[model samples]
Target: MPLYQNREFTTLMTLKNSRLRIFLASCILLLGACASNDELDSQANAAEQQIYSEAQKYLRSKNYDMAIKALQQLESRYPFGKYAEQAQLEIIYAHYGAYEPEAAIEAANRFIRLHPQHPSIDYAFYMKGLAAYSGNSNIFSRFLPTSESSRDTKHIEEAFTEFAQLLARFPESEYGADARARMVHLRNLLARHEIDVANYYFRRGAYLAAVNRGRYVIENYQGSTAMADALAVMAHGYLLLDMPELAQTSIDTLKVNYPDHPSLSDSGEFDVAQVDEADQSWINKVSLGLFDPPQPPQFNYEP
Candidate 1:
């Protein structure tokens, strides 16, 4: 070989060796950086798991406030961690256990919105309905024997709708049977609420309004336990409105379906003459129920 060619070949070999060394060094640095990242991720996951375990302990002890706080911290600190979604779901149960129904419902809703395809999404829906159902009772009602059917129907209706949605979307869910049972109770409560309003209107001589409420119950709540009372209210309202045919129809239906109802006489006649006497005299109104006190008429049905 010629001398100049030999020197050129030696220079080319040196340049290629330097380039390969730099490439190997770059790959080593990248692998080290990747290892460091993996270590940090493992540490973060361990911390998240620790917080979640603590939260679970709190929940098992029924210390719902602490459980909620710890769960919130875990969710916020490790938003993408493996435990984050589980923390969000348990937050709902913590709130529910604390008897904070509105908070539970809100948390459940947030979980549903954030993790629509989560495997436990049915649990969120079930909890939402259960929270609403529990919210129907106030602090006073918790201690007292107040009737839930007489209270505002807002929470009751909301719970019913939520349970219905759960049934529609997760028909085979483990919570389906419980949700269905609660729905049946809610349906009866709603029907009884309509009957209560009808009785109220009837007592105040708003016969047409009473009739409308009774008709609403009959149309929408046919199979409920309140059906007997609804029929009685309808019969009384029709009688007051001077619609004998309608009254007779209502009475006949009551006789066939609810023969043992209190509103029915032993001879199968409609026995609600006292309801007609519910109108208050002007003196009774002026006396604030002191003199000639008006008796509030009631649907005579076994509660």
Candidate 2:
């Protein structure tokens, strides 16, 4: 135990103590960093929850525009948050509530693509179909004397297809029953639209075109109410085309199915005399029914 040996031992002890202090300080700094991260995460989650709550409140209040804004903010801020998917789903409803059908459809489509396995996927599809169905109507049509069956049926057909897909994929969905009911209405509308087109062609002396349209309705929309009108069109067109046997077949079928159809006489026969009398004069045909007008044949039942 000399003085130099004692001093060396003391220096070694001091160095060891300094190194231990540095190690402990590093550990403390790391722990503080982790705690800060946890706090920040908690704050972020709280903010996300707050935004989601506000969105829900807006939705419950039927303030769709504000709900959409809040939902969009939540999604943009925390795309991977717990409420992100729910926010996306609610955005579709918000747009629909705002009467923005195309936007709702697009949002629903986006949700379907992004979260294909989401539990609410069926809801997305249902909303998409509903949006398309709503898109077929407008404020004007509600007030004005408009014939929806006479307008372009592209949107209506799209809605029908959308609902069909929903039923095919999610047969037990809660929305299935309503979707089915809407589909029946849409199918009838489509059939009537085809019959209206046939009637148009028949009025313009396009008997062959009218017959083709009627045949299309019969082949595609068999169980529809338009079947009787389709048969009448086919019968009248066949008579005009000099196919007496085909005309007779259609007339007989119409007689059995729709005996009280307008084109039928009191004796339960197709009124050939009325159809023959409906032929337009040359002047009327040239004028497109504008001048020298003649009563055109109407194969559709008015009742």
Candidate 3:
């Protein structure tokens, strides 16, 4: 329309065109960088394949050391490629299958640290626990410590800890089911140990001490087969301390809870009337002022 309006319109069009050109140039530069990265990736993939192939052959031949070296080389060459993850798992297996327990665990741990979000992270944890399990030896019993060679149970516990962590963190993992089955056995052993300590205190003359120890078994190991015996021992201990109320309470619990409960009497199982008859004899012979059994014999052998 007007000359000034035309100039302004031309200026706006030019600015728009410049902005569009700048955006197009940035896109071209981005594409060029992507192409360069792809080319490098292609070269890396080829080298990774070579290293992986060699490592796999070594591993298959049971040459763990050589396999480890080749896998390590692959890691150094292409640290972030698909082959890198495969190499990492192979390294763990190499150390594990070769009986290098500590190295296997370390390799598995390293894989986890580096690839925390990996879909196969559960496998890494399971492998670490397996390494721990392989290291554990149950050769020595707690008794005969001097003669028996003691096997370190640390690895067993560590294995269990790692397995439990896997189950807890990745419950849906395939390994979680097996982890639970092993835990059942470990927990039972611990429960039995507590019962043994309780029985030890009960055999001594420490009634209060026995009561406390028995309580541990009852509270902590409710379903253990030893629980009924523990409750019975606790009741006996309470009776010794002249606390008939607690004793009766414990007895009631024992009878209600344990269908096959132990005998309440410590000496032996007998009828209530027989128990009273035995008590009567005990009172007659021991307590003199109130009532005493008559002296039976006084014979003179003098001429």
TM-score for each of the candidates: 0.74, 0.76, 0.49
TM-score of 3: 0.49
Using TM-score as the yardstick, the better of models 2 and 3 is 2
lDDT of 2 by residue, 1-303 (tens): 799999999999999999999999999999999999999998998898899889989988989899999999999999998888888888988888777889989999999999999776888888887778668777565446555666778888888899899999999987788778777767777877777777688789899998898899899988876777778889999998999999999999989988877778999878855542322110011112211111111132122
Query: Highest TM-score: which candidate?
Result: 2
lDDT of 1 by residue, 117-166 (tens): 98778989988887897788765766575566778999989999999999
Model 1 segments more than 4 A misplaced: 1-43, 273-303
Evaluated at residue 254, the lDDT of candidate 1 is: 86
Cα error, residue 240 of model 1, in Å, equals: 2.9
Supply candidate 3's per-residue lDDT for 128. Answer: 79
Better candidate by lDDT, 1 or 2: 1
Clashing pairs in 1: none
> What is the Cα-based lDDT of residue 184 in candidate 3?
52
User: How many times do residue backbones clash in model 3?
Assistant: 0
lDDT of each: 0.80, 0.79, 0.66
lDDT of 3 by residue, 1-303 (tens): 999999999999999999999999999999999999999877877777788889878977879789889989998878886777777877888877667779988998998999899777887887777777667533242122321112344665787798899998999987787667555544443444444554456557677887886688688766654566566667777877899899878777866775444343454331222322321221111112211111111222223
